[model samples]
Target: MKVLSKSISLFVVCLIVITIWWIGTDGFTGFTQETARVNKLIEEKPMIMPITLEDSKGRMYTFHELKGRRLFLTFIYTSCGTVCPQLEKNMQQVYESLPREILDEKIMFLTISFDPDRDTVEVLDTYRQYFGSDGETWRMARIANKLELKELLDAFGVIVLPDRYGGFTHNSAFYYVDENGRLTNVLDYKDIEGAQAFLHNELLGSEMK
Candidate 1:
């Protein structure tokens, strides 16, 4: 009876260990699966609808100009004090980690402000300065037209809601587009390491093609 009880206890402990391992690994496994799924979706539908937007200099920008460059894009507003700052910081880290050749020649980093009413071209320029961005590799912009902004946000799956403190809450992530302008991957801001890995392995080399 004593030996049988000991064996049962050992089996239960092993079961618990296995359960913990599965739970710990589920997040990475899920992210990998999601990446595969999104890749397949891009393969099926190659083209994304083009939208016109304005940069901090009040100059018109379009997707056509982004062709043949790996695009790292995100949405943020100057008034946001919560996730936006950290999200941008993570992007900055990813940008700094890359080789200068990739940053200057092969990649474009874009931050678009969803709050057009409050985030004018001047305001975005100030915000860009605060982040120490030179606007060469990392460019900040805002959508001028309300209707077009709504369509752009909806297309990218960004949801914005008004908060009680006169600010807004929104989902933030990096939208990764290939050199061909195909929407490829959506990396959440929390996955900084994953973003860096994708940049080094997929974007910088010929593996992505």
Candidate 2:
């Protein structure tokens, strides 16, 4: 009877472990289940983050104000002088790939500064001009409220860490939001070709409807 009891306890422990693993891996999808689950969640129920934003032009607006326009959004801190500049340049190429006339109204490129205290309205405006952005179609904005900034970053999975050089080390990615304002996809920062292709298919092929 002791032998049977011991066997049952071991089985129960193993079953518990398996259950934990299964849940962690989202039904055993993969070892990197966090990414898999996030992708799945975005596809199934894309999120809409409601946060107030102030543009470099000193214009304040809520995220809901951008509804009915497709957005290619990303985060940046102007002082970086390296990663942030490259990200802007790369996005510029993708921005130029599309027709200028079709931009700003239907589709927009928004770069939000996580460090609003340092990257003031004037700072962001100056930084954007370095990359030839007209400030209308390709906008630079910031979240002045620190509390709201944290919430927005967490919602979008953007990780920003302070560096020894008084700058930030943050993940770079283009977050694509559809016309309905739902964050549908997150593309890698270096994927220039993929970004262009998505724009072409999304705008050139189906923009009219």
Candidate 3:
């Protein structure tokens, strides 16, 4: 009787351990599946053109590098003391709140300057530092030509109308890209809160470590 009881107790303990392990793995697996479902819905949204550009540091990074991770990209001119400043601050908030693991997990941030003629590599570098960028994972690029910038913006469906005071009245949007390097959603820069939640639930939440 004693031998039988010991064997039964051991079997029960093993069963319990297996149950916990299964739950630990399966729970996150289920969440990933749900995230995938939402991502499929996100794919139905219109796509944007991908640009290959040189960063302030002279490194070449393409939209292709953005694959296997999530991307948040924006257009800005550093010299503007207007809405651009507000947008930068809001972007800082979004970046600060993101999980560190997510930042390391193939995530990218791209800031393209509209006034590329004045936004040389030196200017871009200084501007990026103002936003507290560490330079390990972000790209700040200069447009190099007014016409080229306008054409690219138009291709992406973002418009930048010149302001009389040398600044521009441009469309303010924060673009999201998925792990497949495909363009996803375009949200207002001021909608940082909503943007964070959307990306977390729809993208990062499904990321494999």
lDDT of each: 0.80, 0.85, 0.71
Model 1: CA > 4 A from native: 1-46, 207-209
Clash total of candidate 1: 0
The TM-scores of all predictions, comma-separated, are 0.76, 0.81, 0.71
Q: Write the per-residue lDDT of candidate 3 for residues 1-209, one digit (tens) a residue.
A: 99999999999999889888677556434344433333443556544445556678977655565667677878888878888888888887777777776777657777888887778888888888988776556668866655656766765566677779888886676777766766677666888898778767775656544
Candidate 1 vs candidate 2, lDDT winner: 2
lDDT of 2 at 83: 85
Residue 7, model 1: lDDT of 100
Q: Which 10-residue window of candidate 2 scores lowest in summed lDDT?
A: 32-41
After superposition on all C-alphas, the RMSD of every candidate to the true structure, in Å, is 6.4, 3.6, 15.8
Quote the positional error of residue 190 for candidate 1 in Å. Answer: 1.4
lDDT of 1: 0.80
lDDT of 1 by residue, 119-146 (tens): 9889988888766677878899888878
